[model samples]
Every structure is written in structure tokens, then in C-alpha cells.
Target: MASRTPAPRQQTHLAVLIDADNAPAAIVEGLFEEIAKYGIASVKRIYGDWTKPQLGKWKQVLLDHSIQPMQQFAYTSGKNATDSALIIDAMDLLYTRRFDGFCLVSSDSDFTRLAARLREEGLTVYGFGEEKTPKPFVSACDKFIYTEILRASPEAEPAPSSEKSTAANVEEAPKPAAKPKPQKVPLDFIAKVLDDIADEDDDWVHLGALGQNISKLRPAFDPRLYGFKKLSDLIKGHPKRFELQARGATNGGSKDFYVRNAGIAR
Candidate 1:
């Protein structure tokens, strides 16, 4: 005789808020799939005016996904009440202590404070936005998912234009114009790390070390700009450019170690 056991439930509760103005309607489907990876999305709300013609596409998405639409009529031209409403709701949710994490879906930098505030209350914040999202908002979250890449199937998106972020939300502020194309990765510093590892007889330096080397060489280096998160994820995405390996721990800590080696491919 055998007894069946109940399955354990995922401990995370995610609240997903989409800014209709900044997010594409088509990303709705891919959005859910991405959220499922983190946890069950118990509270899903989209802020915008549903009666307007501009929101027609999103109306169908809301109905299909059973997302609650919070209607906020545009108070003035070129002004969005959506961001304010979402922030208010986020604070309310934060006080209730119900959600384990908050998913802020918007490319607008307006929510940067909201994300940071939520984290201040000890809640994990997962942000979903376009590549044009401001660095402050992107870095404020525990993790940020670029919706464009997730929407696209297998084929990778072209290299991020150096001007994308600055040109994105021009209505918000003025930014520097783009310059001519430049080298993708700073090779000299990368070469230094590789040489250092070579001198030590280490086939691979910890990805952390590699990142530090890169940062020390270039303070502005960001894996997100290169289409990746962790150094390991970035390295894995560029199989031809670099080789990765799991390295032995230094002491009793079992933190997974990653190593990178030069490859001529890309």
C-alpha cells in the first residue's frame, strides 16, 4: 500500500502592475509566462483609460488574462495618471504585507522611486520594461526583465543601439545624442583578466572577478546593455566569445563559482 503526498506550494506572491502607456499590448502573453517563472501572480492590475480608443488593443488583453483594469482618465495632455495610481496602489499593497514581491511593468523612469520604496520595506521587486528603461529603475529592482527580448522568439535581437536609452523617453528630459559605433566589449581590460588568470595557472577566473576587472576598467559597463543579467548569463549567451566553467569553492561557503576563458568566436 502506498500513500500519496500533497505537493508543496510556491512561497512567493507576485503583484503585477502594467503601465499601459509604456508597455506594449502584445507583451501580455509573454508577460504571464515570465511571471510564472517567479511565482503565482495573484494580483494583476493595469492602469489606463479603458474607454479610450488608444487602449482598444489592451482591452482584449485584459479580458483574456482576467486582469483588473484600473481606469484613470488622462487629466491633462501628455500627462499620465497611470503612474500615480499604480504607485498609490503599490504603497497600499506594501502596507498590507500581502505580496512577497512586486512586478513593476513600465519603461518609464517614474516608477523608479516606487520600486526602491517597495524594496525598502523588505519586499523583492521584479521590474519588467523595455530596453529603453532608465538605468536607475532597472538597477533599483532585484531583477529586471526586458520585455522586448522576452517577446521575441529564439532569434536574438540586434545589438542594443547606444542611443536607445537616451532617446527612449524624450518627453521626460533631454539627453546627449548618439555617437558613432564603438567596440562592443573593452578588450584591453578583459585581456588583462585573462592574462592574470593565465599567469596564475587558473584556466578560469571567477565571473565575479571578471566583472570587477571590467568595472575597474570601465565604470559604466553594464551586462544589461549587452543583453544579459549575471556575468554567467551574459557569458553563456556569448558561447563563441567566451568559455564558462564551475570552479571549486575557496573555503566552506558553497556559493557556486563561475569561470570565463577567452574564445575567438565573437
Candidate 2:
């Protein structure tokens, strides 16, 4: 089988810090699944007031995921103690120089400066938040993932009983998972980037390199936002506007793929 791209020899060690004050318990399963694509989560920590009833939903989830909970009491009515605690911990983790990156999970914009600081120190930061997340927070990270695309695992299907009618069994079959709501593809951005970076002599550009450039230009740019699984798929889905080429593959190993504007005429 021809691989899409060569895999990195090593995964980035990441510090996964979550602000439980804003993020929900539902996305925990999907959140980690997304994280695996980048690297190992060496440190999984969530900051919140565990005593609050609102946080009760996260208790079992933390245990299941082996995420250590840091308790921070709310000392004032209007202040957010959890954010302060998480920020301090993130700084401490950054100073350790043990992690290759950080995954900050929250929809709140307060962590914007923290994300900017991490990038300033030369560590990659991945921010996870809802679509409502402020642009400042989204752009501060290396790549931002909208939690709207993340989903909880579906409950297991019940086994069919000998006593149940066939029709009933058919009716009870699990419904297909709901897809994330589609967002408009940044077609203008994609076209401009292709022209700016990899229209080399008006030739094809390596897909991997193109992906990196796209992330650099727009940290929150994800194919999932437009309902595609990969950058290549996103390009291919717009065949009228973009073109692709697969080159340099031997014996079912990884292949070097290239992409260019269809107008480039290969």
C-alpha cells in the first residue's frame, strides 16, 4: 500500500493541560484520540474545583483517563481560580523543558497569552476549543482544533436477544454518528498559499510541506472544519481548483505526494 506521507521517527512528548472550568467532559475521549496523531501525552493534568457539582461529571472521566486533577478553590465570587492554577502549572511544565509541546484545552480566551508565551519559548502548542473560541486564542497556538469537531464515543450496542423480534432488532441498530457541522473552506487562502509557496517554476509542491505552510499561515486551519479528514482530501475534494501527484513510492512504502493549483497546468 502506498502511504500518504512518511511518518516522523519519534512522537513529540506533550504536556496536556485542560481548564475544566470551560471545557466539557464529553470531549475527553475524542480529545485524546486527536492528540495521538501528534505524540504521547506525557503529562495529563486538569485544573478545577472538584468539590463543585458541575465538575462531578469529570471525576470518573479523569480516573478513566488517568488524568491527575489539581484542586484549586474559588477564593472569590467573581474570579477564576482554575485558570490561574492551570497557567502557573503550564509555566512550571514549560520551564522543565521535558515536553516537546503543550495541548491547552479550553474555549476560554484567557489562555491566549499563555499560548503565545509557549510558542515564544519555541515549543509547539495545540489549542482545543469550541467554534466560539476567540480568534486571539486560536491564532496564538501552533495549530488550533475546534472542539466542535471532537465527539464522545458512542455507547455500546446491546446484544440481540433470542426473544426479540427481527424487526425490533433491525430498528434498534445503532444510528450512524453525526458529522460535525460544515464550515466554509478557505478557498481563497488555499489558492493564495499554493501560488505563494509551492508553485515552484509553476510546478507541483510537496503535500507535506504545503500542509506545514498552511498551518503556519492559519493555526486554526483544519480540514475537519470543512468535513474532510486530511489536507490531501480537502484539496482533492476541490478537484476543479487543485491538482495532485503521487511520486517516489517503492514496494508499498510511503510515497512523496505533491499538489498544485490546477491552473498551474502541471
Candidate 3:
């Protein structure tokens, strides 16, 4: 019997470019953490006029996070020299074909065309910006994440109100409840994609393969956006709509997870 050859190790290498002028310094920690979920950040660079006092906060954190600050002095009063510098560097990097993807961090719509152009060359583009970022820019990338979501405290919860109980207390007006977050990835969408990609004979799909299909179908589809850390956990959340099964691995030592539409008979 011949020994089986191990599968090739495939990992995505990403170039992270930040517009320090438009993005906040506080989100740097969360931004990198989020990027790690997709792949390793091979190049981390931030473009801005480092001499300006406004970027002082960013300067303090640059060395700590190992982010390279590219200084582009203001050439004119109104024209944005930082944007031009970042764009030029991005194109240069793209031509090198050293990165599998690029992470463009900025709320400015000026980078919208840049993101689109990168995607045209068959490289994945992940965008990070504030919620107010223009729709055109958000839609241009393969994935877009709001920076506000990154800076949010995962353990933080609404504080309880304190009120003194008194005999003279009258009926108080009802306070409006906080609005629930809208589902970023709809259950229907997941189900439809699973059904479309499932094997006809097997009637089941590997959870890993399903995730890839989902990304291809909806470039911005991420489990984190829906409050789940992993795709398996996300599918498990919708137990009624999907069925998960654990089978022995191909090597016969461990287990592999698979899923299928709940309505489909095993």
C-alpha cells in the first residue's frame, strides 16, 4: 500500500492599507483582529502626512502594532496628496502579485475606484470603514466592515436604570426599547445557497465547502457579521433550518462536519 500524500497548505496573504487621515486610531486593534479571521496580513501600511499634529494619536500606536506609516506631505491646500500616494502604492503592490487579497481601511469614497480595480484583477478586496461610508464604496469591495462594529466592546451591555421607590410615585412614561440589530445574512439566503451547492447524489455538503460557496455568492458574507465566530456555529444556530452531521475524516482518525437542508431526507 502506498502512503497518502498530505494536502497542500493554502493560506491567504493580504496587504492591509490604511488611510490614517480618514480612519480612527482606536479601531486599529480590532481591525487587525478582524483581518486575522480572513488570512495573514503580509503587509501593513498606513498613508498620511505624519508631520501633521492631527495624526499624533496614530503615531503613538504605530510602533506598538508594527504598522508602517508612509508619510505623504500635503502638496497643496485643497488637493489630497495622501490619497494619491496610497493609490500609487496600492497599484505598485498589485502588480507585484505578492498578495492574495487587500484590505483597504478608510471611510473616504475616494478609494472606491481603487477597490473596484483590484477586484477586477481577480484579487479579493476587504474594506473597512465607518457606517456613513458611501454605498458605492461599500458595494465596490468583496467584503465591507463598519469600523464602529470593530471598536464595540464585546462584553459591554446596557446599564440598568436606578429609580427610587416612593409612595408619591406616579405612572412613568415607558422608555423606548433599544432596536435589535438587523440580520446581515438572512436564513433564506443561506438555505438557498446550501441547496444550490449540495451534491445531488449525496444531498449533503461539507460545511467548509459551503462557506466557500457562500463567500463566492455573497462576497461580504461573514459569520462575524452575524455574531458567530465560525461557520459551523452559524449553521448550528439555525438548527431547525439545517441539519449537521459529524462523520469520520478521510484519514479515518478524526471527524469532519457536514450539513444539509433540514427538509432534505438523509
Best by lDDT: 2
CA lDDT scores, all candidates in order: 0.75, 0.89, 0.85
* lDDT by residue (tens digit), candidate 2, 68-173: 9999999999999899999999999999989999999999999999999999999999999988899999989999998878876467666777777587445665
For model 1, the local distance difference test gives: 0.75
lDDT of model 1, residue 121: 89
> Lowest-lDDT window of 10 residues in candidate 2?
168-177
TM-score of structure candidate 1: 0.64
lDDT value for model 2? 0.89
What's the TM-score of each model vs. the native? 0.64, 0.86, 0.75
Off by over 4 Å in 3: 1-12, 76-78, 152-185, 250-254
Please provide, for model 1 over 1-266, each residue's C-alpha lDDT reduced to its tens digit, 9 standing for 90 to 100.
Answer: 89988889758998999898889776787789889988989899999887788888788778789999999988999887878999999999888888999999999999989988998988888888876788888878877877765553443345555576465553443232232222265445565666665535456667777776665444345565565555677677666656777656768856655655565323
- Candidate 2, clashing residue pairs? none
| TM-score of candidate 2 relative to the true fold | 0.86
Q: Write the per-residue lDDT of candidate 3 for residues 1-266, one digit (tens) a residue.
A: 99999999999999999999999887888899999998999999999998889999899999988999998999889999999999999999999999999999999999999999999999999999877788788889888887766773544445434565444674454443232353565889889988888777887899889887876666556676677868888888888998999998677587789998897754
Worst 10 residues of 3 by lDDT: 173-182
**Which stretches of candidate 1 lie above 4 Å from their native place?**
1-10, 152-242, 246-257, 261-266
